[model samples]
Target: MKVKLASSYGFCFGVKRAIKIAEGYEDSATMGPLIHNQNEIDRLKTDYNVGLYNNLTDVKPKDTIIIRTHGIPKNDLKDLRKKDAKVINATCPFVTTPQQIVKKMSQENYSILIFGDEAHPEVKGVKSYGEDQEDVHVILSISELDNINFKYDKIATVAQTTKKKETYLEIVNALILKNKEVRVFNTICDATFENQDAARELSKEVDVMVVIGGKNSSNTKQLHSICLENCQDSYLIENAKELDPNWFKNKNLCGITAGASTPDWIIQQVVDEIEKY
Candidate 1:
């Protein structure tokens, strides 16, 4: 049996930078998980004494607060500033691009349309930038676009950094038909595009595909979806412990790809375990 790894996989620039920032601070708490990977979060907790908090109210004034890579809502930052908490911003610059665009466009009276999951932290942060959250619409697909009744002639659209380019463009193209004037910004991260493309290419050449990453990671989920389209036997797992030998019974070549937040050690472990078969 042969094990193949995607050329572009594992921790991206943002995740690496966030982890480095977190490691530099002691007894610091992140607004949310610094990145989606549970293993890496656990390692940080044990090694760096970092903590995680989901709500702003839980943060203490004297404690250092690390902003997540996905970023926080605009109002949340203002509230934090009002407190005495020491803040360390770890938001990816890629995610910040959309937030800035949304803020500027909303100020100019253009209705905001975000191509992403409404519940996602990154999307919520982007939506908060708009002057009025009511004017900002989060649409995951073209079907959702049909339900939106836009009263504004000018619309500005941006996507979550981890979203697929094809899906984002498709929605933007449809939105252009409905609005007289539309401004579209493709905010998908270059790393995300390269990772997905690499995953797709690996899926085509392998007998089976393995996607390793946190289950909650949006980018990881996207990579798994891309792999599933080309390879029916693709499996999504967090670690080698979850791997079932039965899946690789007759497989000669297995391809492995991980999400942006996944660490290199986890990928290496999965590969080493697969080679044992």
Candidate 2:
């Protein structure tokens, strides 16, 4: 099989910045998995002595704490600062933009609506910035809009950094139709747009598609979804070991794309493994 790589794939600006920041702070711990990629996190742990802390209670006073790229809840950050830990924020500027927007809008008394999965770390962090927690609502789809009862006449909305733009637009459209005053801030990362578009185009031309990234990665799953729409033989895998030789049987062309959190090393490993098949 001839192996093809997507025109745009691998680490985005935010992921790259986070990795660089973490590398400099060896022996420190990240509040959460710095980025979604486990392979890179493992590499950092082994090579740099960086540790992972899943909760605020795990953090110690004066400990070096590097914030995850996804950021933490507003109150969590405040608590961490109160502990006197050396807090280094690695949040992607793209994600921070929406958080700030939500903070400002909520303080101004505008109901905040976030278009994202409530369970996602990014969405959770953004939702916490609202002055009135009850006014802040998170929704995964247009259907959830029905459950929201905004107290304020004016509303402001933002999307998860890695969400599909088309889906966000649908929610925005619904809000505009029902609400008299709506403030929409485009929060989707530009790199996400490039990566998803590239994956969609490559999947259309290949016999099989391989998306490389972490299992917990929202953007990687989105890429897999896009690929599946174009090629049913699309597989989402974290590493080369997960690749099945049977998936590539008789396939003439294999296209590979990765989430923004993926590294070049992982992508190369997948490509090398595919070539062997």
Candidate 3:
């Protein structure tokens, strides 16, 4: 079997920046998983001495704390400052843009509508910036928009950086149709668009598709979903060890793609393992 790599795969600029920032601060801990890839996080722990703190309360006074790329809640940052810890902000600029947008628009009295998973850390952090928490609404689908009751005449919206653009547009169109005054900010990351497009294109030509990234990663899951639409044999795996020999049996070609958070080393490992088959 032959192995082919997607045109756009592996680390995005934001993830690369966060990894470099984390590497610079040895003996420090990140408030959360930096970029959702456990293998890379483990690499950082072994090589750079960076630690993970799942909660804010786990952070200690005077500790050097590197904020995760997803960023944390507004109050959490304030609490970190109060703890007298040395804070290293590694939040992706793409994620930070929506947070600032929510803060500004909400302060100006526009009801905030975020098109994303409500439980996601990125959405949680962005929602916390809203001046009026009651006015902020997070929805994964356009159907959920109908359930929201806006207290203000005007509404502002933003999307999760890793979400599907097509769905976001549908949500935006629905908001415009329902409200006279609506502000729409396209917050989806460009890397997400490229990765999804590449994955879509590659999946069509391969007998089997393998998407490499952390299972919890939103963008990785989106890639797997896109691939599955084109190729039924698509699989989502974090590393090379998860690749099953049987999946490639009698297959002529295998296509591989990775999420924005996936590292090149991991991708190469998977490629090497596939090549052996």
Candidate 4:
């Protein structure tokens, strides 16, 4: 019945900073999903009544628009400002690096490829940075790289900040197969890499793995995937209440890991609940 938790299981610095900014911005609306964690988002809504708008076109002139940590494109900023909406830039500094690199790569006429979940908010923003020009494509996985038909003479790649290093490297190696001149920014955030590494290590030694985070959380899903790879006894849940005690039947050395967006309190609650059983 013993339980072990990964040291890197809680909110990463980037997610903490983004949430702090959101907490401070009272009476404002985020331009998109503030964080992947629904529990935190639900809390924010209950306390601050903060709103979310994917399209700023209908935003009230007096409302302030906060950009989520994942960030938005340059054109979106211009348009928001033109609409007389106050723009709060909550973009994680790590995410900004890839955006800057994409801009630089586009100017150099090198074929640009972004490696990450194409449907993710981070990847969507990265894509926007290159959408103005026609030289960019996004590859979410190593398998997607085969579809890219760009010339090998000039190529550049960047990863979403929350991607696992293994997946990122897999896609990078795929690109290398087709192009020798490929440039990579290694844009994956340090926090994400540490969290995944810790989870992977824990999964190897644990009898069962519990990944705690919102279902919408991309990084949490990745962590769960990593756990499943290392140990089949892996489950993803948003809260301790969602966990069924029967799943741990006759199991020991339970491993618990949370996503970057998960708050410490939720993690502790889950761990405490597991201990109670």
Candidate 5:
């Protein structure tokens, strides 16, 4: 079988930066999983003795806290400050752009509409930027736009940094049709768009596609979704151990792609293992 990898895959600038920051500090703990990939987190834990805390309550004032790339809510930052914990803000700059825009637009009385999953940490952080969290709306699909009942003359929309550009644009178009005045910012990261496009292209050329990344990673999931849409035999796996040799038994070509948070070493390992088959 011929194996091909997406042109754009693995750690993006933001994730690399976050990892570098985390590596620089000793006796530090991340506010959450620094990035979604468990393998890298495990490596960091074993090599640097980094700790992961789900909430501030578990962190001590003396311990250095590294914020995850998917930033925390505004109130959570305040709470961290109150606790006097040493903080290393590793929030991706791309994610911060939407947060600033949402806060500014909300302060100006524009209704905020975030085009992303409500449960996602990045989306939750963006939602917290609104003047009133109750007024802010998070819509994952065009259909969800219908559920918004706020009577605002002006609406401002932003998307999660890892969201698909096409999906974001589709939601923005729908918002324009439903609202009188709509201000939209394409908050989706450039790398995400490129990665998705590359994955789609790679999937089309291969008989079976393997998407590597953390299952919980939004960007990785998006990649898998795009791959599946283009290729029927696409599979999503966190590591090479999850790979089933049977999937490649009759396949002539295999495509590989990974999420932004995935490390190069892991991707390489997957590639090596697949080649063995």
Candidate 6:
């Protein structure tokens, strides 16, 4: 049996930055959860007085606010400052671009639509980027757009940084058919695009694929979807301990891929466990 790993897999720059900041400030008592990864959150709990609050209303003044890579609401930040929390920004630069674009669209008086999963923290941050007058809509699929009847007027669309390549284009093409003035920005990060493309390619060559990342990880879940499109034997496991040997009983070749938030050491352990089988 042979094991192949995806070339474009592993942690991206943004995840690294967010995690690095969290680790650096772990000794501080004021930091919050750096990102949504449960493993990382557990590690952070040992160092900082981190609380997972949906809103900032629970944030105290002395707390050093450790912002996640997805960024936060402008009002929330302003409110945090007012409450005297020392803000430690950890937002990813790739995500910052869409926020800047939204500001421009707001000034141009265009109705905005964000293509992404509505429940995602990144999508929520993008939605909060809109100003008072600009109306931003979130679309998970093309079917949802039928409810909003708007003409070929000034309309702008931006994608969440980690959105799937195929789905983003499908929506863009669909919108182009309905409105003449529809503008789209494929804000999906370069790393995300490369990772997904590589994972999809690997799925075709391997009999089984083992994806390593937390379940809540957006990019990791997308990688699983890409593998499922090509190979049904794909398994998503957070770590080596979760991998069941039965899944690969008759497999000759296995492909291993990790999410942007996955650590290399953990990935190696997963690979080692499979090798022992």
* Overall lDDT per candidate, in order of appearance: 0.92, 0.94, 0.95, 0.84, 0.90, 0.80
Regions of model 4 farther than 4 Å from truth:
none
The C-alpha TM-scores of every prediction are 0.98, 0.99, 0.99, 0.92, 0.97, 0.91
Per-residue lDDT of 1-277 in model 5, one digit per residue for the tens?
Answer: 6789899888999999999999998779999899999999999998898889997899787789999999999999999988989989999999899999999999998999988899999988889999977779998888887788764879999988887777788888887886899999988898888898899899989999999999999889989989989898999999989999999998888999999989989998898999988
Q: Model 3 over residues 195-269: C-alpha lDDT tens digits?
A: 999999999999999999999999999999999999999999999999999999989999999999999999999
lDDT-superior candidate, 1 or 2: 2
Reference-based lDDT, residue 53, model 6: 51
> Model 4 over residues 59-99: C-alpha lDDT tens digits?
87878888988888778888899888888888988888898
Which sequence of candidate numbers ranks them by TM-score, best first?
Answer: 3, 2, 1, 5, 4, 6
Candidate 3 to truth, TM: 0.99
Q: Which residues of candidate 2, in runs, are more than 4 Å off?
A: none
User: Which is the winner by TM-score between candidate 1 and candidate 3?
Assistant: 3
RMSD of each: 1.0, 0.8, 0.7, 1.9, 1.2, 2.3
Q: Kindly indicate the candidate among 3 and 4 with the higher lDDT.
A: 3
What residue pairs are clashing in model 5?
A: none
State which candidate, 3 or 4, has the greater TM-score. 3
**Candidate 5, which ten residues in sequence have the lowest lDDT sum?**
144-153
Tens-place lDDT per residue, model 1, 1-277, is 6999999998899999999999999889999889999999999999999999988899777889999999999999998878889999999999889999999999999989999999999999999999978889999988998888665889999999998888888998888877899999989899988899999999999999999999999999999999999999999999999999999998899999999999999999999999999
Local error of candidate 1 at residue 63 (angstroms):
0.9
